[model samples]
Target: MKIPIRSECLPYALILSFLSIIFYFLNKYIAILMLILLAFVLFFFRDPERTIPFDEKSFLSPADGKVIDICEIEENEFFKSKAIKVSIFLSLFNIHVNRSPISGKVTYKKYRPGKYLPAFKSHASEINEKNIIGIENEYTKVLVSQITGFVARRIVCWSKIGDTLKQGERFGLIKFGSCTEIIMPIDTEIKVKIGDTVKGGLTVIGVIK
Candidate 1:
């Protein structure tokens, strides 16, 4: 099995492990606890390679988490029309990385600073601080938003406007705990539902007819 740890967490894990080593000289019990926490921090950021579906008509999930909601909304920012929004809520245990759902050129990218509401709340999608990426292919434009939660303070995006992204390619991640959203055209067929478990890059979220 190929275990790919996201490079972003190395500095954090190393720092915590180093502190644990120092704490060992002061108190063995505290040192042991810190070591255990370090292990979890490393695990939280683990980005394993997945067998993504090779389908040109399918849209994949952007983050590893549970499908908290599926709703229809007027997405005024990008689509400027009706769209089906699939929201995934990530806990501390879920992988924080985000991926591209389709192979397309990034046509729009925007970062909005706002409140850090709990990601589980449906309104977090609109009100929370977020990084929005819109990818466009010949058929349609898809928007993926990475939003901050109560605890998550950082949103990292690697793809910029005009960048070409292959399906299931890594684009960015939300630090600690957050939410990811994939907004597709209203007429698209959704493959997943509320409460369904999903894995980033591997799970198919919707299909274009």
Candidate 2:
């Protein structure tokens, strides 16, 4: 059991636990409270412990949640244009680790510090705390934005702007609960529909054009 616990955490479990303990002892009462909060954060941000089974040949869902929306939006990244937007909403109980949807080189990565809105609200995409990752795959470009919800306070992204990523690779994690938006080329086919439940690194949400 202890082995499995350590395995799931990769190399960060000990560090996280050690910090949690130190924090707990420094402010016993507050630290105890934070430890409980940390436990919930660990649980919610937990990454699934299985291979997605898809080779670098297929596109995968970047998040584990429900597809709340699919729309067209004005992309302000490079060209300052419009693109098809696919939004996935992560609830407090949903896993918050985000994966790369397709193999590509990250072209743009920016973080916007903003307000924490309810993930279910329509304005959350624009007004909420979020981090955006734009990738260029061959001839196609896509944007994946991690948006924070009311209960979410932290967003973690591991990939740099010039780093290369394979399909379904773990690229980032959002603490607590939040939402993510994937913007694809206008011609890209959306494989998942609104209300469909998706799992990170496992479910197919779209394909590169």
TM-score, predicted candidate 2 vs. hidden true structure:
0.79
Model 1, position 105: C-alpha lDDT score: 98
Model 2 score (lDDT): 0.78
Give per-model CA RMSD: 1.2, 4.5
> For each candidate, what TM-score against the reference?
0.96, 0.79
Q: Residue 159's C-alpha lDDT in candidate 1? A: 93
- Candidate 1's residue-wise lDDT over 1-209, tens digit each? 77888888888888888989999999999999988988888888898877778678999999999999999999887899999999999999999899999999999999999999999997887799999999999977799999999999999999999999988999999998999999999999999989999998899999998
Best by lDDT: 1
Q: Model 2, which residues run further than 4 Å from truth?
A: 1-42, 55-58
